[model samples]
Target: METLEGAELCFPQLLNTSCRKPLQHHAETIFLYILLSCISLLTVVLNLLVIISISHFRQLHTSTNLLLLSLAVADFLVGLLLMPLQILLIGGCWFLESFMCGLFYYASFILTSASVGNMVLISVDRYVAICDPLCYPTKVTQKRVQISICLCWVCSVLYNGVILNAFLKHPDRYNTCYGECVVVIGFITGAVDVILTFIGPIAVIILLYMKVFVVAVSQARAMRSHIAAVTLQGSVSVTAKKSERKAARTLGVVVVMFLICFCPYFYPSLVGQDMSTSVAFSIFGVWLLYCNSCLNPVIYAFFYPWFRKSIKLIVTLQILQPDSCYAHIL
Candidate 1:
């Protein structure tokens, strides 16, 4: 009944409920609209470039790097497909007519499910490498890693499919506005998603990482044993041990990023989902999730010497070759 421009006008009142001081509705709407659009487009394009650079370069195609590439690709798709339309919605311009809405949201939801699942898998991979060093190679072979990646997609599809169908508009109830309500359907769907996406995966990741971190520490102590056992072999053993530590540290960053990027997406369910409240909370979630696209490259750049070397090598060769600008010189 009452139109309070958009998220801006409503946000302050939301924080200070008693104050009831509304924002300049139109100005806030316009600013939010522009902000979302710029962020969406910019992040989308950057992630695509990152994916291409990784794929096109031979030196950057290790198993771990491949997993990172998949993450960037998935997040890039979320930014490109979902965020731009969400920006339009924030501007009160919902261009996805009734037909396309379900399909678009379905793709976005499924891919996001896959993305979180993959994060869990990546943690497991790193955990195995750090904790069970002897078995890591035999257990996580190239074939095994590929199979795990495929299983991630499979799990995402089945999990989201059941949940989506549970909320699907029944043909029998389609005509009755009084009996068939979308909000009730939305509440059920959101609750299920919150459990599968956040609760389940969060539990698994924490348990696995705890094991991994503890093992990493123990192994670090074990390095001292190498000094007396084989003084000449100490250098090789230490190098291997350092690599193991670095992988664990990278996984720590991955866990923190996943938690920060995705927690907002689940907050609406944790709080009571009054329509207006849910609207702002959901938008914040989407924006935070979109922000994750820019972080992987940055984290890798700062923390991963191997990844930095690969990126630098790729860039250097581009300047060296005219026709084959993408090829590495070495």
Candidate 2:
């Protein structure tokens, strides 16, 4: 009986202090690990493709694609780092040191926050492109977009640093036993994080996209009404309008998916409860949010012809040819 009990402890030698292993069946454990490992690998490969396509193809370099590139980088790290650690967590033990646990969560928060910022930036980009096409070129230049991306990342790092300061300083503060890692946020702090990281950004995204939708619909109606009277200049204007409307629709789907994946994760904070990683719902929420990173690249592949074209070039080794960067992707 003693030996059996010891076998169930995460650290058998430290029986009194160690956490008991979670009661999972052997086959169930193996299946979960395999499934999650495949997802992590898929997320990494897909996001890496997005990163390569945008960075290598000269024609793919636009203000909007730059924002996507930033998002892909964040998602890529999620798959490469966070997903693996999360897989370890499914075994119900923290094999690494306390400091590493803190670093893992800190990096997770930074990547998550940066993703929110990038979505907001994408919504704003589509808004301007659709609503005020005449001034979009001057207003949303590549230099300005680059500056905004930099600010987005810097602010995410600083904001999450402040939010997780206490946890970082003492990663084992809330642990119940050895082999466990957890973080608990006080109610006030959790509420503030929800507002800053979730609510405020979500509001901005929905509002901007709402305006984009209205304007796009109106423009479509006007173009259809006057289709017969289109001169060469009018035809060019109509074509540009069609392009903007299509972009708005595609990005609208992305924003909606972001909201769906993120809302449940923030529900506890929204309800004025303290956020704790030890809860079952929190674990489910975190995985759902991480799954969004994988989904984004799939969405791009479905909607963007340029991404498909670039994938073919990349897979066929055509990208290794001289001046392949100049290949027509758009």
Candidate 3:
């Protein structure tokens, strides 16, 4: 009986200071490992494609795709870094040092916050383009959008540093055993995190999209009425504008999916509790959140013809040819 119990401990040699392994069936564990491994791989591949498509294609170097590029970067890191670490945690125990544990959560919060920030920027960009098309060219220039993205990422790093300050200062303060890795925020700090990261950003996203939808419907009606009266050049411009709106609508779906995946993870904080990754439900919530990174490219950007073309070029190694970047994708 003692030997069996020792076998279940994460570090059998450190009996008293090791966490017990989670009681999971062998088949179930194998299934979960395979499933999450696929998610992580898909997330990495899809986001990498988005990154390559936007970075290599000159036509896609617009203010909007810049935001998407930032988002894909974040999602790419999720698959490359966070998802693997999480899979390790979910397996049984955190074999890494406590300091690494704190660093992991710190990086996770920064990426998650950056993703949210990018969504808000995307929403604002769409809102301006749809509701105030004339001013969009002046207001949402590439330089301005690039600056906004830089600030978003900088702010995310700084904000998470503040939120995770305690953990940074004392990495193992929350650990109960050598094999355990955990992060705990106080109720007040967790509430603050929820308000800033979840509530406020979500409010801005929903409101902007709401206004964009109303204005988009009205514009569609106006365009339809004016279609016959417009000249050829004017008609071309209108078509281009319509295409912009279509892209916005696609990204809006991405934002909604992000909210759907994240809300459940933050619900415990809404109910006045710190997020605990040790529990089964919390781990499930975290994985669900990470899965969003995998879906964004497929659901939001992969449908574009230009994206398909870019992928073909990339796969065939044609992108390395002379002036490939100058090749018209759109």
Q: How many residue pairs clash in each candidate?
A: 0, 0, 0
Q: Candidate 3 lDDT, tens digit per residue, 14-95? A: 8777888877899988898899999999999989999999999898899999999999999999999999999898766989
Better of 1 and 3 by lDDT: 3
* Residue 137 error, candidate 3, Å: 1.1
Model 2 misplaced stretches (Cα beyond 4 Å): 1-7, 227-236
Distance from true location, Cα of 8 in model 2, Å = 0.9
Instruction: Sort the candidates on TM-score, descending order.
Output: 2, 3, 1
Model 2: per-residue Cα lDDT over 122-214, one tens digit each: 999999998777788889999999999999999999999999999999999999999998988999899889989999999999999989989
Model 1, 233-310: lDDT tens per residue? Answer: 233366777887887798689678878988876676767462222235446876787677667666766776655555
For candidate 2, the lDDT comes to 0.90
- List the lowest-lDDT window of 10 residues for candidate 2: 227-236
* lDDT accuracy of residue 126 in candidate 3: 94
Ranking by lDDT: 2, 3, 1
How far residue 25's Cα lies from its native spot in candidate 2, in Å, is: 1.8
The models' CA-based lDDT, in order, is 0.65, 0.90, 0.88
Q: Highest lDDT: which candidate?
A: 2
